[model samples]
Structure formats: structure tokens, C-alpha cells
Target: MMVQCVICDILEELDNTAPEAKRLRNRPIHTYMCAACHERVTARTNERIATGKFRFYRSSRRIEGDFYS
Candidate 1:
């Protein structure tokens, strides 16, 4: 299954077995806004990711583009 970002509707697959995945899965279904919207809502999301709240995986395309460009 996928979790859609509250602000942008970008879909991300959920991995329940992985360690990082487990942390997120165990938490409540909290709302996560897109980058821009997150800035307005609060600084929590950015802070969480920075502090290792959850492991993040970017889209393969984005990774490829970043390295190839």
C-alpha cells in the first residue's frame, strides 16, 4: 500500500518490515504535508527527518537525476 503526502498527494510505498519502516508503521497515521506546506504547518517534519524520526527513501528517478545531471 501507499501513503499519500497530505499536501502534494505524492504516493510512497510503505515497507513494514524494515527497521525504519517499522518506526513509521508503528506510529499513528499522522498527516504529512509537502515541502512547501510543511514550512507553513510547523518545523516538525523537517526536524523529525533530520533527527532520524524515520528513514526516508527518495524516488529512484530523483536519485538518478541528481547523480547524472
Candidate 2:
């Protein structure tokens, strides 16, 4: 299957039976990022994390028992 990287907009080919190809075929919301762009992003993110000011926030899941009397 052929897919385009969302970041660089470069086209690349993937084997039709690959798990990633299957994901792109099955989900329209999922995005494709080429290896080069993925590595660039990872490196930049690691730099930010190393600065000690980067905060990674995640939603806290509430338990049902917490709300019960």
C-alpha cells in the first residue's frame, strides 16, 4: 500500500500485509509519518524533555468507586 507522510508529504510504499498498512487502510483518522520525520520529531522531543521545563500532561481516569457513597 502507498501512503504519504503527514509531516513531509512524501510518498512511500508499504507491503499490503504489513500491520501499519492495515492500520492506515482501516482507520482514516490515523496519520502516517515517514521514518526520517519520525526520527526528527523524536530527537526534538527528547531535547525538550531534557530541558527540565517540559511537562507531559495526561488526563486522569476517575474510578467509579471514588464517586460512590
Q: Pick the candidate with the highest lDDT.
A: 2
User: What would the per-residue lDDT of candidate 1 be over residues 30-49, giving only the tens digit for each residue?
Assistant: 55445566675556654665
How far out, in Å, is residue 50 in model 1? 18
TM-scores of the candidates in the order shown: 0.32, 0.82
lDDT of 2 by residue, 1-69 (tens): 889999999999999999999999999999999999999999998788679786556533353234222
Backbone clash tally (model 1): 0
Quick one: RMSD of model 2? Answer: 7.5
lDDT at 1, model 2? 88
lDDT, candidate 1, at 50: 60
| lDDT of candidate 2 at residue 43, scale 0 to 100 | 90
lDDT of 2: 0.84
RMSD of candidates 1 onward, in order = 12.5, 7.5
Worst 10 residues of 2 by lDDT: 60-69
Error (Å) of candidate 1 at residue 33 is: 6.0
